[model samples]
Target chain A: MVDVVGSASSLHYAITGRPNCSLSAAGTCCVFLSIATITLIVAFGFFLAGAWVVLPFAGAELGALFWSLRYVCLHAGDYERLTIDHDKVLVEHHTTKQDVRFELNGYWARVILDCQPNGYCRRLALRSHGKEIEFGRFLSSEERLNVGRLLKSRLGGYLS
Target chain B: MATTIPIQDVHNEHHADNHPDHHPTGWMRWVMSTNHKDIGTLYLWFSFGMFLFAGALAMLIRAELFQPGLQFFQPNVFNQLTTMHGLIMIFGAIMPAFVGFANWQIPLMIGAPDMAFPRLNNWSFWLLPMAGLLLIGAFFVPGGAMAGGWTMYPPLFIQGGPSYDMTIFAIHIMGISSIMGSINIITTILNMRAPGMTLMKMPMFVWTWLITAFLLISAMPVLASAVTMLLMDRHFGTSFFNAAGGGDPVMYQHIFWFFGHPEVYIMILPAFGILSTIIPTFSRKPLFGYRSMVYATVVLASLAFIVWAHHMFTVGMPIASQLFFMYATMLIAVPTGVKVFNWTATMWKGSISFETPMLFAIAVVCLFTIGGFSGLVLAIVPVDIQLQDTYYVVAHFHYVLFSGAAMSIMGGIYYWLPKWTGHMYDERLGKIHFWLTAIAFNVTFFPMHFLGLAGMPRRIPDYALQFANFNMIVSLGAFVLGASQLLFLYTVIKCIRSGAVAGNRPWEGAETLEWTLPSPPPYHSFETAPVIK
Candidate 1:
């Protein structure tokens, strides 16, 4: 599905694939915090019962859980946007940490679908004049194919 | 998910469509991969390596007992071998092997894109090798590995040297790895199922894994707590198990078996799932009692928690408590019996094929039942009082673990190897391996029952002259069993290298979602969610 963000003079397609998190951010935090707190209480109980060595192991386990949850959530914000008109296509890619933009001549743009021998979609990239930007990393293979096809058809007439 | 091969012309349309996977090559591909398939491969291979290592330790234990007297190793060294053997086989071999299966099959079966948290999946697996190294590293320490058996009971456990600390630390690491793995699996199974694939409709392997994951989450923490206390008593002067320090030694047994009993169920529950999957497939029938099988699984897991005291029957408890644990432990046999009966009913008079996997499945039913009966024998307090810590207990668990968990794992491997490698192993050789394994396995552990009945105690490096004959037979069978495993290693490697090509559904009656995908599957399986009908 395409989410249009610009006027007719300059059309834009922004395809964002967030982590499939069913819970809201706050709900996610609450769930994890509950787990951590319960684990801590159990460990603390053991400590009070004279098994204090369990505390560090519990901390490490909670720490791993916290870090992994954070990593998944952070990557949920990743996005890829393609802004194009009659002249050029500008591609902006947003990872969890940084945003990168690649500018290419719209007339020279080509959409490449790296597919498997069995026709499974692998990767989708936009290439032009030795400059390329690959996106759809978080998309399903079918979604990637649709995105590839959309770009190909929209830019077919302008191919240099 | 609909399977469609991309048009070759479409591929030719672009210049940069050169490789299917953009991940790194060589060693870094394994270490850096967040892909489920890659991580699964790493886990399987690592577990196989540990299996051989642990199996070697078993061979040594047998070699020492070949003629009743310690021929090669000292008592302490022998104790270390037994201790490490149990720890490695349970933690390093069976558990990780099943987790590998979960990693490889769960996402494919559920039609999710991948595990819920792929990076954490990677982290969970890598921790295993480190934990294994620590356990192994204890051998090189100044005092050698801890000789206090894998159970790590206090007093004796607390008296060990520096290596005991290493062992305890290793247990903590492995426990954390298990807990993390269970969390990842639990989240993935709960939230990542395809649109139409409800829980009941999931494959038996997935169902069993879901239950087993919960068991892990519930059980491993107690083990972690127990070991943590062991560590504290050893170093921190805290006597949680020390009576002199106002702690009770038997309390450690209570805590350890609280985890240990469920731990046994944890190992076998997935095997139950594997057997359920295999039996129906070979019988050319839908599972006869699918819902009952799931119900039996849940009942069995719940029952596991209450039966912990059964193992301590001989430890001097009140008659009421003994009676309670005895009856509770014996009651486990009922649900387990339901499972066995269900498998038998599933295969009763159907158009059955005796393929290698089915052979292992059938053997597991017969042999594991024998193990179950022995467990029932041990469950009776009067009998257990006579048989505790005897060769009888050894025979009982080996039957359950070797013939149950280990055999089912081998069956699963055979059933899935074609799919995993995109090639069929040599059928003739496969059957040969199964026969050798089945025969040799029984010959190895079955005699221990008689030995136990005749009053042979377990975990000792030497035996009296009266028990010499059975030990000799068991040791000989152990040698044969150890050698037969090499045949399995050879079969797997040969299949991977140059076996015949396998189609998407290698087995004729297989009808799981995994069978709908191509053999060897793509690196990114289920890129789109598959709709289950």
Candidate 2:
């Protein structure tokens, strides 16, 4: 998804992308815990009915669920942000670990959409001077194409 | 646990995926692969292998019953055949086959790179063969396989020797595999969907699997618990089911069916999901009521938990409790009926086609409803008491599992094989396979209904001479049904080896994300997720 700051003609755009997570990190934890809670309650219900053997197995299963979902929640905020301004193009890739940065001279920067033979975009990038930086790594192929077209028309770049 | 890798950079490993040399060659590619498609292929082939083995066991059982006297193995061996056939088909064939479909199609349909936990997916597939070995190995143990039926009821279950422990250990292994697979499915569906692919927007197949995973997570452990108690009774001297030692065997029944009946849905709900997928595609109509289908599936799964005691009706609970279970079991028919109605209505005034997949889909709706009605008939306490261990009970489940779950899996294969293999299966042979299966299946199992009503108990090698005629007819049908599946195998091989090319979208009506990519999609084709409208 792309965001615009300041006036539309100011030529400053923020094209941002993140993992598609409808449930927030907390909500994900809540969902996992909720399922774990219900499963334990049911397992204990059976245990009290003299099926005590169910408790350990249920605990083991929930342990897996809890571990996996916690892993997912920890990375739910992983995101990417690229802003094009008058002089510089700044790309910030933020995961749980680090905020990596990439910069390009805006005047010489060129947007590229590397497409497969079937017209599916394989990668989207911006190249300037002699270096290149790939963006929209998290977006879908079709989404990259849309963002490519948007950036090309505004930046006055030609398709390769 | 966090899914963070370097961005704004090229990892040599990511780029190496394109180099042929970088990919593992030969058996290593399959045995230790993290690829979802490879794992799905392994699961499918493994299940089919198990299917044929179990099917051969069924043939032996039917052959022994062809006449009315002991012809082949002894009565004990006949019991072994029946018990192993039930256990293997349910565990090794039907359940895993659906999981195979889930492994392959779920990621494709949801537009994810792969399962959330790729290595775990590989582990899930590998564990099946080990479990299968123990199962088949049980037959070679000192006293032969457990003959106490697949339910493994105590007292009779306790009488068995070393083979019994092998079977229990096999089940424990399978439970672990199922739980791991379910966790991957649940996490992937809930977290890894492409942007715009919301929960409600997911395909019915995905929705069904999501619900089915929950059922597995909740019920499979209960099964592990029940079997663990049985193990304790055998070696640990805990009388959980030992009536001779201050315990009730009926309690085992209560606990087993608590896991077992949802197991019935665990096997079929995904098939219902398959029907929802195939019918609308063949009918050229949007599903008649998508939201209700989802709600009805949840309702059906919820009902499965309460209605398990219906299986134990003859074991004697209170009259009120019996009535409650009876009504609860019967209540399942309502959501089941809704699913059938929606499938029918989806075809109403639409461009319906009778492709092989469609043929199987239509047959499943009609035949599974027949099975559901039989279940309703048995839901009454009086009728259940009459039909409890009879061939009628056998007839009912075969109708659902064989015709319903098994057939849906076959249809789904036909529906998706073109996409998987990049070639259309021989339409001629596929149709023949379907007709032979549908016709011969009825010929084999239909008469069992009559044999059952006339009081021929199941799991017996011989019956009274009065039931001889129907037994002969049933045997003939089982043989023909068994033979037809070989044609199915040939058709698949022939399609994969040499058939007309199928471009990306083989079926014009297919609108899922998988179809949008190339047929036989690339190894990393889904690295960029597809957005739903």
Candidate 3:
């Protein structure tokens, strides 16, 4: 079997890709999306309100009723799932899936942690051959350690 | 070949091996605590204090409104009471309670040792009490506390009493505290996770908090700037919002709502997290649509920024602007609906029980829906035109804040009291508190809907004779509701002092890692991390 711990390091690199998608790029995308989406939603609320007011009393009530119905429709079902194997971590939801895998042999990998003193958990990062992958992006330190050990034990021999 | 690895040694290597004894003692401990749990406790106690303070103000307002025609205080003082009461409760009471929960639980649930920036946590928390002092101190100032509503819209705000500066300064400080707190939360959540804990496997509470933090960081600064401009207009003769200074007052509303709307979600999303955690545990089921809940929170946060203008529908923006805000505002219900349905589905066919926490969770679901329905009503331009600034609007938000947000917080406290105190709460007392709060809350706020429909405006000291009876009833309920909170405090204190000792997992149904540890968890938990199956 492939060494799981070593694979985790390689997997980290594959997940984050290269210098192409920098942290700044992701931050910019997040900012752009936030401003664009908020502006659109506020504009739409005004439109419906105006239409309701211009209409007669019954029309206004109908508008209110319709708004409620639409509200329910737009807000109601959406979630994602993640799983880990020896060579890769899999994130899947609905119709989408991303598999990140790594090769442990002849590659050096290091674990990086983000520690918080006030009640937040520390995060783990695996870096190998100039590429970095973060696991436990959603877990606390204890959970990360548990997962980390399993991978470490499995892949220790393959990684330098 | 045999190899022995000390579990503690391995655990220490994996986590931050900070020695708790090295921390300062006595009053300095509180001032310098970087421990999330310690900070969390500080936040909780502070919020409780603020709640009582605001409640006192509310009682005073109710006493004045008890018989109408102004009995207890003058109109100006009443306005101050109303305004300060709203500001204190929203900023000081409810929001801090949620943050308190976040600080305490996020690290434990995620299995991390602490928050990312512990020192910053201390700074964020200390700012609250100081801000509170300044705000309450405003009453002692020469002119008395501000009388404009909590929104603190300008023009009226600029011309307010001397205490206006104190209130504004306090607000600025509070806003700063919130932004820093949000930043800490986001960085910790984003950067910290143990091995194998993928984002999708994270708890709903963590996911919701992550989104709420994002909302706080992005929107709170805008509010700070808006208020800063208001301050400048008042003191420095700048006119960002003053019409005579070539600035439009409407511009202030736009900027304020942009921040204000998301701020509402920031207050409530954690409640959503609390409800999500409680409902699943009580139902004896894992949260249904776990990933969906995360998505829903993100979608809701995204939508919150857009729908803010709906608050200004009556302010006469162009038709296109109204349509956009209304539609966008309406769209938010979609993601929110997903969360509600997921909770209900989590309960469907599961071994559900009506423990006090679950009861509160259930009440939150039902009552908050009523609030949401009213929110939809407000989203419609014509309906809002009729209801805007009326008691109808009053009823709408009280449902959301009091019943929705506050109720969930209470439930969370009750659910975790045993865990925090190492003792089970008096169940009978808990039930009484729940029933009293539920009944009193409904009695207080439900009629405001009818009062609103009758066209009684809010924030007024006196009303016409026609609106007298409902107001009287509402005032009575308000007294009862205010009185009921004492029971909660008593219950918490009693449990902490001398309730029956609870073993690990006081609630047999609890599934989280927190329940796995002994009640009143050790100074250090999971010295040897427990493996998740």
Candidate 4:
């Protein structure tokens, strides 16, 4: 789910992370459209047959499928971007409705990899000047750890 | 206890295969494991166990039917045997077996670490054995299992003993389990694909399972509602089905068949997915008409809802309604025919090989079409009126379900057992088992068509002198068919316990993501998602 464009040898490391989805936005819409159409026709047909109980379950199921698909499509545009150079670090996060950016001195930045008991990195963040900003929210645990390692290699441990 | 895996022990994909010993140990490993492979194994084992149990029930039913008059239990017990046989085989055996395939292959095929919700997957699988046990446990209850037919039609259902309530409760549990399982599969398929593994590019098995999950989500709730109403009619004083309370008994049939019809598709669609997967691998060609196959599956699943009334042509329907359902039922053949044609075209003039899986897939395609044709015969209003409760109906479903779904599961097991166990199965033994199963299956269920046409009804313990000969043939075939499954069990066990090393990609034609890894894949796989073009 994460796309790391630069490695330890690159002067500037650029990492991009995006949510997982089986289809593009248009594709998701097409899936939902077909499902919704069939669902309504089936539910309505049963309702006509006096089995009105079927409609609620069908509607609820339709809502669940749509909600899952919509969630995927909504986050489809969201991404996390990080740029690290010799002196400075840049973190940019974008959601469907918001974009946030931050810059910090690479000398003072430190990487935090909080691995859970199962050894997956549950969170990755950068800290400088007594403040911390997290990115890689959309990345898998391994990707998050890899990103953390790349950042740490650029910036040594920060002062406590 | 599971090994305490630390960050330092983890590796990139390059080293993952080097240290492939993260497998847990002890009893709790099975009880608390969240591994997708482990859970898939559990589901398969439970399904096979249920298959044997239900097949034993059929053996007893056949034993009693082997001779003419009252050779075994009385009619009430015979009723229990027939009802429990149908119910257990359908829910406990076939459905769970397909779910087992979905769990094992979906993540591996799609290049994901595991299911989207691993804990939820565990709950879904564990719930099945509980529900199966609850249903089977009813046999030990004072009045025996529910005997109002698996359909549980009203007035007969109205007078059943405590076992009826137990059946109702067990059905509820299974329904919940099925719904949860379907949701997990849907989410996993929709959101867990590799970066470039587009929907159009997914394996046919994935597509079929996805469609089947949707059917489950749509159908199982209706079943829950029907059974809940049945429970209410029995104890809670609601007349949802009670005729004495001004409810129409036929209304229960309407509701039950509505769920029942889709339930049949639920059992078969995954088999179609399996056939699509296996035929192409053995043919050494890309699937012919992949898009059409996907469309056919969708069309078939969509048509399942509108055709429920076809089962009720004998229940005094309006002539117009009868005509509509009959036509709608027949319309299903178009898509089903598309599937059959696609399988055949895929095999046409190709370098085809008959691995055990391929054999089962081929047999499923041919025999299931026969089952479908029989269904068409039954779909005719007048024909079904005579054949309503006859052995022909029983034969039709066994062809569809046993040859179509159950055999595909057997085939699917043979196809994947090598990959799963890291060792090649006994091929000669596998082929022998497949032949025995394929031949005996026909011997058992095929003759019921003639018996049914002769007007010998189903679910009866005794029959007239005229019906005796065919029943005996059916009983003999049934016994052979029942015994052949033992060979299948041994083949699987031997493969798992020890065999020649099956290196990764045991079948050179296999192009899926799973085959790219070790024969038995690492516990954690696709550490960095392999982008599929």
Top-scoring candidate (TM-score): 2
Instruction: For candidate 2, write residues A1-160 as lDDT tens digits.
Output: 3444554346687767877655677777777877787688888898788878889888888888888887788777778887778766777878877777776656566887777677777677776553456778777778788777766765646455
**Residue B9's C-alpha lDDT in candidate 3?**
22
Of 1 and 2, the candidate ahead on TM-score is 2
- Across B1-533, the per-residue lDDT of candidate 1 in tens digits comes to 21222222122233353444455679988998888888888888988999999999999999999886669999999999999999999999999999999999888888877888788789889999999999889989987898998999879999999889888888878887898888788667766777677778988889999889877765666788788788778888887899999988887887788789989988999899899989999999988888988998989988987889888876788989988888998899888988999999999988999999999999999999999999999998888889999999999999999999999999999999999999999889889999999989888998999999999888899989999988888989998989999999999999999889999998998888889888898776766576677
Any runs in candidate 1 off by more than 4 Å, and if so which? A1-160, B1-19
For model 4, how does the per-residue alpha-carbon lDDT over B24-134 read when each residue is reduced to its tens digit? Answer: 689888888778888888989999999999999999999999988999889999999999999999989999899889989999999877776688788888888788888
Ranked by DockQ, the better of candidates 2 and 3 is 2
Per residue, candidate 3 scores C-alpha lDDT tens digits across B1-533 of 22332212222222233432234569978887888878999999999999999999999988887776978788888889999999999899999999999898887776655776788799899999999998899999887899998889888999987788888788878977886787667655554444345667677888889888777766655666667777888989887778887877887787788789998999899999999999988999999999888888988988887788899888898899888988888898898899889999999999999899999999999999999999999999889999999999999999999999999999999998888889999989999999999999999999999999999988888888898899999999999999999999999899999899999887777887778777887655543334445
Q: Could you give me the TM-score of model 2 versus the true structure? A: 0.91
Pitting candidate 3 against candidate 4, the one with the higher DockQ is: 4
> Which 10 consecutive residues of model 4 chain B have the lowest summed lDDT?
B1-10
Model 1 steric clash pairs: A119-B6, B1-B530
Better of 1 and 4 by TM-score: 4
Q: Model 2 has how many clashing residue pairs?
A: 0
lDDT of 2 at B526: 71
Docking tier of model 1: it is incorrect
